[model samples]
Each structure stands twice: as C-alpha cells, then as structure tokens.
Target: MADLSSNAPANQFRIAVKKQKVWLASALILLVTALLAPDQATESLGFVAKSLTQTGPYLLLSIGIAAWAVATGADNLIARAFTGSPALMIFLAALAGGLSPFCSCGVIPLIAALLTMGVPLSAVMAFWLASPVMDPSMFFLTSGVLGFEFAIAKTLAAIGLGMAGGFIVLALAGTHVLHDALRDGVGNGGCGAAKIRSPKPVVWRFWEQSERVEKFGKEAVKTTLFLAQWLTLAFLLESLMLAYVPAETITSILGGTGIGPIAIATVVGVPAYLNGYAALPLISGLMEQGMASGAGLAFLVAGGVTSLPAAIAVWALVKPRVFALYIGISLGGAFLIGLAYQGWTLL
Candidate 1:
C-alpha cells in the first residue's frame, strides 16, 4: 500500500509529460510540413502570425481574469453576477459573447480558464454558444452583405441559442442525463485545486503578496501553455484546409434549399466556417446561388459554434461529456434557429 501510494504521483507525472510530448510532436511535425511548402507555407505562416497577434490581447485578458478568480476565490463574486437567476446570468453572458471581438477559438482560453476557476458550466456554455455566432463587427458585416433584416435575425438567433444552451445545462443540472457538466480535470486536472488560497477580500491588493504572485504565475503559465499548444495545433490544421479546400466546394453544395441542405450545412460548417468576417462574403455568394435563408443561417450558426478550430480549443480543456453537451446544444440550436428563420422567410 505504501509503495503504491508513493508511485501514484510519479505515474501521474509521467502521463502528463506524455501528453505534453504528443502536442509538441504534432506541432513540430506540422512545422516541418509547413516549411516544406515555401510558397503555401508563407501564407500559412502569415495566418498564424495574424492569429497570434489578435489572440494575444484576449489571452492576456483571460490570464488576468483567471488569476484574480483563482487567487481570491472569486467564483462567488462571479456567482453573484445575477440575483440567483441562472437564466439572467446566462442572458448577460450571451450578450457579452455577442459583444466580444473573439472568434470561438480565441474565446476558448477564457472559457477554459473560467471553468477552471469553478465558474458554473451553464453561464460559460451560454457565452460559448453566442460568442462565435455574432460579434459586433460580424453583425455589421453581415448587414452589409446579407442586409439589415437578415443581420438582426442572425444576431437574435445567436443570443437566443446562447440562452437555450445555458438553460438546457441548467435544466439538466441535477439529472443524470448531463451529469458532471463541469467535470474533473477542469482546473488543469485538479493540479492547483488545493493549492489555491482564497484571500479574504478577493481584490487587487492581494496580488502584492509573494505567495499570491507565485500562485498566479503558476496558473498563468499552465493555462497559457495549454491554450497555446492546442491553438497552434488547430491553426496548423486550419492552414492545411485553407491551402487545399476550395471555397467553391462549399458554395456549390449549399445551393440546395431544404432540410437535407441545412443538415449538410451544419456538418460542413464545422470545417468550412472560417470566421464571421470571412464568412459574410461566402454566405452572400451562396445566396446568389440559391442558398435558402434558413439553410444559410443554420450553416453560419453551426459553423460558428462547432468549427474545427473552436471545437478543438474546447476539447483540449474539457471532459468528453461537457464537450458533447456543448456540441449537442450547438447542433440542436443551429437546426432550430435555421428552421425558424426559414419559417419567417416564408411568412
């Protein structure tokens, strides 16, 4: 018994190192492949650089949020975001999701960190659903290409879907159907769970303490490293798609206007939906090719929530059940929203 207990930690450490090596190996392989294609690699590298630049500020913001929440044990403070109404909290978070500049991939670090800090799964799920669907810039761009009414409808759908995801998780909280929505390993596999010290007042002054600084530093590095590795892997995969997958292939299939088309859109959106800004023109072009309004909306919503980049980001930090719930809500919501938009169009 004593020998087993002593070896348990060493076993865990070995597993962790193995995981890190896999990520490192994959990243290194991708780097080598990208280097081999000098002309295409230039574009891929450019995309990576641009992505990192944009994601940096958001990553830093996540670090600050994570640091504070961890150091001061402020999950309660976040818990107090509303008056005991999970629905209202979900609504507010959904609104913030629409407002933030992040694409879904960019927001994962924050979501991962937030969940790690013990923020309830419902609100984070709410933000997760809405953030990628419609940001402020995406809203305006969608309006410019798809028109004002379409833009407004898409925005409403984004928020409504967010609310739906949050409430769905809330409803299932005590039920076995979605048990452990915030699963174990959420705080980096429970590594720092016990080490965290809740300062009396959850404030900035606590940051001055050497112990607090040390804790914050460890948390920051752990989070950043985890996020950066997954993100780089996601970006490398995206670069491959961008280099090879033709845009016309997407628009061609989306021309059909029925349930089948919408279903196809949902599936395809995962790999094809780049980002809202890039999608506006593609969706607009699809419309010209007889893409149904509802199908188009479905594609955008589905793509936003479950795109490869974003899904990979979420999967890296969450358990299988939580990830499945996030996806279930995304697909289900996208289908409903698409159908609703179609009905409105016919009216």
Candidate 2:
C-alpha cells in the first residue's frame, strides 16, 4: 500500500545504525554532555583524547599481535591441546585458553566441535573457563590500562581458574554429574566450526604470501577500529563517572580488603559488567575512587567468565546441570584467585 520498495534506503540506514550502536551511543553521550554540561564536556573530550594517545603504543602492539595470529594461523594450534591424556590435555588446554587469541564468542564454535568430537569434558571445561578471561591482545590492553603486575596476575588467574575447573570436572567426570553435558542439536554447526575441524597449518612467514599480507592488513584495521571504539566509550564513561560518582561510595562497597569485599565484587561483577575492554577504564576509575585491588581482580575475573554474553553462549551450548557447574566453578575459582592476588599485594 505505502510503496514498500521506496523504503528500502530507510531500512538499510536503520540496519547500518544498529550495527554501529556502540559508536552511535558514544556520540550520543558526548552530544548530551555538550548540551547539558558544556564545561565538563570539554574536559571529557580532553580526557578521552589524552587517554587514547597514552595507550596508543600498547594498542598498536596488541593490534599487531592479533593480526599476526590471523595471518600466521597460530590460533589453529588451540585445537591441538585436546589430543593428549586427560591430565595433559587439561594442562595444555588451560595454558592455551590463557594464551590463545580467541574471544569468548569466537571460541563457541570450537567448543561445540570439541564436545561433538568426544573430547573429554575436563579439558573442554578448562579451556572454556580460561578462554574468556585472557588472551594476547587482552594482556597488552590490561597492561596499558591497569599495570604490568595487574595484567600478569590476571593471566595467572585465567590459567589457574582453568586448571581448577578442569581438575574439578575431571574428578566429577566419573560420577555421572556431567552426563549429557551438551544440549541436544546444539553442536551441529556454527560460524567457526571449520577452523577447528579442518585447521590450516601455520605459516610463520606469512609476509611471503600476498594473501596473508592482505589478511594482516584487514585484521589490523578491524582490530584497531574495534579497540578504538570500545576504549573511546570506556574512557568517556570513566571521566563522567569520576566526575559524578562519589569516592566514598565505591570505597564503602568494594574497598578495604578481605573476603567480604571480594565476594561482593564477584557477585556484582556479573550484572554490572560491560564489554571487557570498556570495563577496564571504568574499573581504573573505580580503583582511583578507593576500590581495593583484590576487589578489582575479582570483579574482572568473574565478569569475564560470567558476563551476560559469555553466559548466554555457554547456556545455549550446554545442558542446565553442566551450566550450573560452569557457573559454580567460575565463581569459586574467581574468589580463590582474588584472595591469592590480595595476599600477594599485602606481601
């Protein structure tokens, strides 16, 4: 009736806007601040600019590493971790989960494939627990936003949580507790299945191939834009948070070390968590407001593993009982890791 074909351009524009929601949101925040709080708007802009410039080198390094992984196909090595004995596989999987380049969502297809392939749940659980928490790009970004020590501690936490989850699942594997781990019809196929099922050999000298050079450039640009947009939004929000949120509020809730604050942080981390990259600047702002290091650690670890996106992906792939165990391991292991880091800081 109303010339539907004529509205194609409008529909396309709406789709484009939806795809760039983060960027649009960032722009909207700035526009509102400019109109409502003109003076603070300038400061916010300066803060975001300065912060981005400061982290520029680390950002570049992270982008390069990610691009290199793509070009050389080093990520394929992640599949190799499942080939050994249960104990050995768990060890390797945990380490790979810490070091591999896959994000939580990106690792989903691989996880599905591994489960379908009859890989033991122990090692799969280990990788699943750790993969969401840390990786090469994440390490450099955390180091830039937080500190080297903090980043290193987080990496260790990732590996440790994976190991703990793996072994616990290992012990329970024989108990029928983990029976029917995956949901029916869940692991048929998905986006990254081919990479896991038919991995290509790594070409360490990827520069020699014209296609690899093109891939490296494309990946570098894609990763750079992704990190830049998220960091921009994060820093902008952080500046506003620092300006508005009172110091005593954060301190009272998440400060002054001990198991109490750490546990609270872990619980809060789940719902309060934003994108991992965005959360870094906000957490830095919170810590500046007197949030304890242990609380910060717990918040990050828990959020990485149990954030809504990660949790939903897991739920879609696994049965309810297995999902419960996953959550249990994530929270429990995050708490222990937080305690360990807190003790380390004290000493």
Candidate 3:
C-alpha cells in the first residue's frame, strides 16, 4: 500500500510537469510566430485588444438583456408565439432586432441561442438582418459621420429589408424548414421549462428563491466565457486582415465603375467579419477612394452576416435548407439594397 501511494504521487507529479511543458511549448510557438511575422502578430493582437475593449460594455448590455429575458420569461416567448403563428413571430423579431443595440457579432450568438431554444428561423433571420444596422450605437455613429438623413435612410432600409427578407424566407422556405432547423436545440433552459409558479405574495416568493440566483450566475459565466472566446478569435482574424491586406487593394477592387464595385464588395465582405463600428473606418477609407455608398453598404451588410463563428453556430443548430435560405436571402437583400442606393444616387 505504501509503495502504491508513492507511485501514484510520482505519476501525478509527472502529469503536472507534462502539462506545464506543453503550455510552455505552446507559448514559445506563439512568441516565435509573433516575432517572425511582426505585422501579422501586431494586427492580431490589436484586433484582440480592440475587440475586448468594445465588447466589455456590450457584454454588460447582453447580460442585462439576458436577465430581462429571463425575468420577463420572454427569452423563449417567441417559441410560444410561433406555436400559434410563425409569421407573427417574424414581425415581432424584426421589431425586436430594430430596437436592440447589439452589434452583428454580439447578436449572432443570442439569435442562435434563441433558435436553439425554439424560436422560429424566420424570426431569427429578421433579427439577424436588422440588428447591426438598427443598433443605437451604429445609428449614432452613422449620424455623426454620415449625417442624420443618411442614418435614418440606412436604419429604415435595414428594417424594411429585414421584414421583407423574413417574409420572403417564410414564403419560399415555409415554417417546416425553420422548425427542423431550430427544433432540437435553440436556447438555454430559461425557455424550456414551464413558467415558474409563484406562491401567494408573488413578490416575496420571488425573493425567496435561492435557485434563481445560482442559475443566473451560472448563465452569466457561461455566456461571458463563450463570448470571450469568440471575441478573441475575431480580434485575431481582424488583426491578420489589417496587417496583410492593403487598404488600397480593397478600395481598388470595390471603388471602380460598373457592377464591379458591388461584386467586389460582396466578395470581400463574405469572408470578413466586422461590426458596424469596426467597419466604419474601412467604409470611410473606401468612400475617400471613390467607392460608392451603395457598395459600401453592401459590404457592411455582407460582412456583418457572414461571420465564421456565427455560421458555425447556425450550422450546428439549423438544417441545410434553412441555412441555404439564410445565405441566399442575406446576399440577395444586400445586393438589392445596394442597387437601390446606387440608383437613388444617380437619380
């Protein structure tokens, strides 16, 4: 027994040492990568730093929204609403998206969570389309940089497009695809359980529940951790783009005459993930280099929607048909909106 105990401790010590060595090796590799490609390293680090800074406040806001959803029992309310009529859920979701202040990245997970919790795909689609453009921060920024009229036009256009897209998706794809996409898993348990019954003196009863507090804390931690990981990855990707891709190249591709600008904008945007605020500097730069406002808008919309993280989340929760519909609608809507903006400018 004494010999076995000693051997166990030795084995445990070796495992701990091994873990430490592995971590050190990984850190060394990262350092080497950074030193070898300073520009890429700086860009990646800058992205992570910038994303963390922006996401700090947004994280708090998300927590508040999540809390509100939990408190009001509306987190999964859409599921209940959809039970009766999916179309109505779509409209409500679009309105909700318009009112929300979350950026594209911030909204994506929430939307996915909602879908996993049983929210209809149509509603999720509406929210995805509108949230970034209709966000208050984007509105304020747009107003400051682009003028109030432009801001209003963009906001209105986003809402209109969101609603139109939702309806179009519903009409073309039907609710079954959405149901199949979201039915299995959509949200945390906040919406899964039936409404919690309060005893007499409901206010007092609410305060008495220790379980709720614990649940809230756990959820807060989970969400924060999930967001932090994505934010880190996003920052790394953005930094790489900034360091390697020439701004002039972006402008040249999308700044020229004909539909070249629109095509270039869409192509460039599809793979790049950016928030409305983050994209603003790029948009301004593109504009300075003669990129059309329409193309810029298209770029913004496309960039916001096609995040790799968000796409992965969607793929995990939704069916291929629903996913295809989402991609098609977003691309189609962006193109049409861009064309309309271009024509308006011409007129």
Candidate 4:
C-alpha cells in the first residue's frame, strides 16, 4: 500500500501544476481571439498602454512608500500610531486619503502593504474612498475647469465621505460583515490583533540588508504584473462602455435640479466618468448644454468614487462586502452632496 503522507507533497505539486496549465491554456485562447480581432485588440491594448503611462507616477509613489515602510519598520510605527485613538485615526486616515495624487489602481499596492502590515480595514477604506476623488493636482484642475464652488464642494465631500465611511466601518467592526476586510486584525484595535508584519524585510535601512533591494525588486515586479492584468480588464470593459453608451443619453436631462435628473447623473457618471482630467471637459460641455449644477456635481462625485479602474482595483484587494460598502458610501455621499448643492441653488 502507498503511504499517504509520502505522496501529499507530490499531490499538492500536481494540483498546482494543473492549475497553472489551465491558466496557460486560457491565455493562449485569449491570444488567438485577440489575433482574430486585430482592431479591437489594438484599441484595447492602446487603452491599457495609456493607463499604464498615466499610472506610472502613482505606482512609483506607492512603491516608494512601501519600500520605506519596510526598511524603516514604519508599519510598526503606523500600527502604534493607530493605537492612539480610533476617532482621530479615522479622521487622519481620511485626511491622508484626500491628499493622495494616485489613481485608485496606483494605490492598490500601498493599500495591500497597509493591510499586510495589519492596518485596520476601516481606516484603509476611508483612505481608499477619498484618495481617488481629489489630490492637489485634481483640486487645482477641478477649480480651474469646474469652478471654485464645484471644486470646494467636492473637496468637502471627499473628506466628509471618507470620515463617514471610516465611522460606519468602525461601527460595524467586530461583526460578521467585516470579517473579510478586517482580515488579520479582526477583533484588534486597527491592525493590532497580531504583530506588525511588513511583506519584505523590516530592517532599519534598505541598504542594511543585502537581500532587501532584491526582495523589493521582486515584489515590485509582482505588483506591476498583478496590476497590469487587472487594469487591462478594466480598460477593456471601459472601452466597451465608451463604444456603446451614447453621449446624448447623458445630456438628455439638462442637468435639472430635480431628483430624476440628479439620479440620472449619478447613474451615468458611475459608468461614464473616466480620468478626472478627461471628465472635466466633458462635464463642462454638458453643463454648458444646460446640465444642472446639482446633476453635474453628482456625476463628478459618483464617477470619481466608483470609476471602473478604481472599483476594479478595490475589488482586487478587499472582500465583496467591503467593496459594496465603499460603493454605498460613494453613492450616498453623491446623493447628499447633490441635494445640498441643489438646495443652495434653490433648484
């Protein structure tokens, strides 16, 4: 009779090999399909390339922060900082989230790092929801393109919504709802359930360890590949959206102050909002065409918060429940903000 223990390792290896072959075969089929649809493939590839180009600076920022955190043992420092006060930490996390310039996908590595180091998911969610909406550049661009009122309102909403998300998540903490996102820190006070752990070495200086750079390099490569695959899928789906969704379909409402128009704007914006920069011009055009200020505000907010790329990035990191909560925060925030703007305008 064969010894079960002796074959366990070999059986596991075989299973892993089989999974890889399945993936390889799937990739080949996709390659063949792409070759058959050359134009569609080119368009999709172009968008992916463009997305990578746009994401480079943010990716560098994420990688830099991750590396520094590992080298200086900053994850532990952050964990300790989180221990100070839950209320304040939520506010600060949301505030930091607003200040980031990275797109949603670009922030994934950093989010992963924070979570891996046992940072609380609620704080991470706050940062996650706020970061994509407006950074300094986005702020300036919005002010220039959409006017000070629109820009200021969005800035306020980002922070408020971020804090709102944090509080809601914190309130729901220690429940079955947060089980997946709370992850390692489940019952602990924001990533303190277990010891702080950085993905790579936790040396004082990067150069102190001979293998630190190599480890970081490998991690960077892995991150880049993981992001590339996900971003490519997002780009492809967005391209289909752009190809099919009619421009007039969005402008039909004339940006009215009513509930219907506002709701329409939010719905359209979820699928329609592309890069913030690109959306500015389109929104401007829509506004000029009698789009209501409230509708525009809702559209911009919803678009930025749940942009396809950002949502995809989010889904890649967190559980389904967390993703749903994030969407709820974005949508609810958009609705309230739009309502306020309309009321101010007496719409």
Clashes (N, CA, C under 3 Å) per candidate? 0, 0, 7, 2
- In order of appearance, the predictions have TM-scores of 0.58, 0.96, 0.58, 0.59
* Candidates 2 and 3, the one with greater TM-score: 2
Candidate 2 C-alpha error for residue 231, in Å = 0.5
Error of 2 at 173 (Å): 0.9
The segments of candidate 4 whose C-alpha lies over 4 angstroms from its true place after superposition are 1-83, 182-252
Give candidate 1's whole-model lDDT: 0.69
**lDDT (Cα, 0-100) at 289 in candidate 2:** 98
- Give model 2's TM-score versus the native structure: 0.96
Clashing pairs in 1: none
lDDT of 3 by residue, 30-69 (tens): 4765889866665556656765675566556555554444
Deviation from native of the Cα of residue 47 in model 2, angstroms: 0.4
Greater TM-score among 2 and 4 belongs to 2
Write down the lDDT of every candidate, Cα atoms only.
0.69, 0.90, 0.60, 0.67
Question: Worst lDDT window (10 residues) for model 4?
Answer: 185-194
Q: Name the TM-score of candidate 4.
A: 0.59
lDDT per residue as tens, model 1, 212-239: 7777788678667755665555555556
The C-alpha stretches of model 3 lying farther than 4 A from their native spots are 1-88, 103-120, 173-179, 183-252
